[model samples]
Target: MSMLNIPLFFQDTAAVEGDMGMLWMLLSGILVFFMQAGFTLVESGMTRAKNAVNIAMKNFLDICVGSITFWLVGYSLMYGDTSNGWFFWGGFMQGEGADLFFQTMFAATAATIVSGAIAGRTKYTTYIIFSLLMTAVIYPISGGWQWQGDGWLTKLGFIDFAGSSIVHSVGGWAALVAAFMVGPRIGKYVDGKVLPIPGHNQILATLGVFILWLGWFGFNGGSQLAWGGDDATGASTVVLITNLAAAAGGLGALITTWIWYGKPNLAQSLNGALAGLVSITAGCGNMTATGALLAGLIGGVIVVFSIEFIEKKLKIDDAIGAVSVHGVCGAWGTLVIGLWGVDGDTGIGLFNGGGAAQLGSQAIGVLAYAVWAIVLSAIVLGILKATLGLRVTEEEEIKGLDISEHGSIAYPGKRQREFEE
Candidate 1:
């Protein structure tokens, strides 16, 4: 091999690796984007039959608006050099910018989770406005705290590998605020009795869960940020841990609900699986398989009680348990990293002999996100409530959001007035 050929070979090799990374991002981003379909199916299927159209509409619009908004604004805010305040130096023009493509999917996801929690009774225009703001402003600014160069939270050693607290928790907290501001669906609670308003189609919700579970491979795996050489080992290992945690979570929730309610509920089991995924997300890159399994089991159990506590005690009407599954479980996942992180760098689990420093950092990060999301979301929804209103009129709500908001019904024949709100 001549020296001239050696130089050319190395150049070609670098180009090939970069191109492969770009392909990985493109494919993974698409898979993550498909999770929108999963969200739509799950949310629409779990809610009452009459509001299915409204739920599906909100989910679809979230991705459309969120993608455009993130492309326009969110990306810069999230990864830019923070020395310039809100205006960062980085643009989406450098390198492959596969990071931009991938992050856009996540931005949309963070915004869309709110749609499920406040389903059935919100105004359509309000949703559009808030979705835009969430993707463009709220989610991005907070995301910068941990991810962007010169981020304060990053300086503090806060670790969120793939956004358990950053993405899911933020969405959850916002969903809680939106649900509270909008108030419960008509007749959700009457005379201190919590009524059960089951969804129209259970099969659809199950399928949605399956789709989301499948998409998670891309969600967590693609976060490795590379596809060259040794990157494959890390990516594959992360995927394996993700799967193990999910399976553990499913079983944990199934067993708990079965013991408590005398029957294992499928819906809860599905959510348990999701909880496990969320719980392990922050630590997946650093955790042992055993650690991930433990986290998943714990997350599954927490979600059941968390759902009940939010519903029965807090009286927040989260129809899809977004607050519990994502918010509560997200915090659990983020904290678990402090306990299971073992990349020989970031994790300092107290029980694992790393002491309280990592735990403190993790707690601080968690609290910061929780406070930011809750306060900001409450303010946004509050202003909306005071001005154009938050919830629909009782008449509209009872008639159902699909017909009232969209002037159409999801099912043409099943629009019978058999049950009254």
Candidate 2:
């Protein structure tokens, strides 16, 4: 009778554990879904008031379209069986319901990053098409190469605990190519002079950053994919480390801008926090607390310089600095694992007594993603430019996409004069 009781007890425990994990995944996915609101607020706040509604629409449709497409095909391609150790085909919508729900949020996130970079000028229909392709094809294929567990990068020992390179960098690279192909916002650069286009509402942008910081807990923690025993501890630790990095990133930008610009810049400081989050995402599981802080700090400082370089030197108009915050810092975050990564009692980085192997693998992963996102994004944008058109007409753009594209305004009546005058 005692022996029978033991077996029953173990069975009950296993059932409880399974239920807990499912609950965690559902909660985490909800948090990640909330990030769409954060993105919409950030992008809309950082651009002119006239284009605010357009920015919201892009972010909204990213999830709407991304969910249906990913459910139908993207999930199969990402987590499905491999045909050549590079791509996959698992069949349509065949995964566990919880897993599918959680992953759908990530796919949408990667697609929405581009909206902020090319806001104010891009056509609404064209943006929707690009978002669909990104969520369905570009994001899933590359993600499978790592998250699928049997892709080439996984076999190469490439480590991206979350998705610094997989999600953020892919989005960043697409932003870079799209921004370049679409060209700078009108009057942004005239006669080789760089013009400043300030965002309409700093208050909204600030609120958006706070929301994003909160959502990142679920973003990093949910990636653990379990809630039993050590999984709980690991997920909690990742959340704490994620917070430390975000705080360090904000401070790093605050100080850097204070010295470089002779004053603290709120926009740069906000972006710095985001950059830090992107930097630590890849190594959050493998890094020490100290390493996470340093990684975020460096990422914050790097974003300031990178934003200036892209706009001033490259002449690209990335309205919200998405490319620097996500793309460049995402690469930095992935590569930093080679300097301070740990695996149980063993080190996984050169500076920490691992070796050059991990670093080399990281470099290869970074370059591969850059090339993939750039080449594919450019091709898609090029086709759109030739066919349906990418940007709105100059007259339509100046009129504000809210009125021109949606035939309505985000802020009407007396508030219109602030932008018009």
Candidate 3:
């Protein structure tokens, strides 16, 4: 029957459900947006106190500047019409306002991940330019490859349920390139001996992790897109698995650090939780609870070793372990789907009796994202380095970016003499 002929009750019921879905989506986006604060706190707390304000500024920029860029063009690039299965130019704001809002947060997240890795030494202006490019161009193109229904990776059956590779790894790999280009913080490596530069406040970092853990419910669960019908169950399961993975990850890291360092290390344990979160993000909608736990456990363990290797062996300075937590675990999360993924009653992973095709597809997607992120990051950062410069001067490095770049301090009247040197 036509809408005009339909009963008011029936029409109201249908409209209510639709409205509820919109509310869920927008709320989830808000939760994800709050994660910027989590990121800021984690990064600032993990670095020297003098650079805390600078760290805060970078994160603020990620959301503020990132939202505008995404609204203007990034959203269109990611979800617009396309026949070539690559990307599209659907003009400005071509989709639903709610979708654009949700995706804007993701774009900001991809850009913010880099801020933590290059925390102590990067220039503010250079970071601004990079953030704009990342939110506007780099992340959207890669994201379209999978999230967009018409994209090639989507056509190939690549499964990244909630962007382990699309969002986290893209950011993670970009972080790797940016860190390498900017080089290590002063005194991080002296004459081949690795020096430990403990964060100014572990408490803040710990709190930040808690906030991120809370925010992740929205990150993974919100990806469900609806709250009625089977969507309610699906979103709930995603939240449960995400929590299980994060808890398992924290435990895994805690245990590994105790064994390796002969003591329980809080820092590694914190990152382990995040690593587990990243590990399960790609497979959260596909894996069983057991599979998610195992994946998270392995991800937590992997992060500890990856952090050591990057800092001690590879000699790269990732101030907050972003590369290992996001990049390495992101790839692992994507691959885990091919090993334990399930589609209702059907098993799709190799260990679950499915063939190797899904595994192969996952690997290809992982490799593709890595290469694309690395190459583009290198080109962008390289140009910025040669032109506007990437790092602050040696004098500014010792004095801190807060005073040098912003002409303000996070905490006033506190003697930074100890932190400056």
Compared with the true structure, what per-residue lDDT tens digits does model 2 show for residues 1-421?
5534676555677666677787787788899899999898889889999888899889999999999888777877887663322222333232267888898999999999999999989999999999999998999999999999999999999999889999999999999999998899988999999998889898999999898888888888888776643531378888988999999999999999999999999999999999999998998888888889999999999999999999999999999999999999999999998888877557889999999999999999999999999999999999999999999998888888888899877887647646443
Sorted by TM-score, highest first, which candidate order results? 3, 2, 1
For model 3, give the 10-residue run with minimal summed lDDT: 83-92
What tens-digit string does per-residue lDDT give for candidate 1 at 93-131? 444367777888898989988999998889999889899
Segments of candidate 1 deviating more than 4 angstroms: 1-11, 82-92, 228-233, 344-347, 413-421
lDDT score for residue 321 of model 3: 99
CA lDDT for candidate 3:
0.91
Ranking, lDDT, top scorer first: 3, 2, 1
Lowest lDDT 10-mer window, candidate 1?
Answer: 81-90
After superposing candidate 3, which stretches have Cα over 4 Å from the reference? 1-13, 82-95, 229-233
Residue pairs of candidate 3 with colliding backbone atoms: none
Alpha-carbon local distance difference test for all models: 0.85, 0.89, 0.91
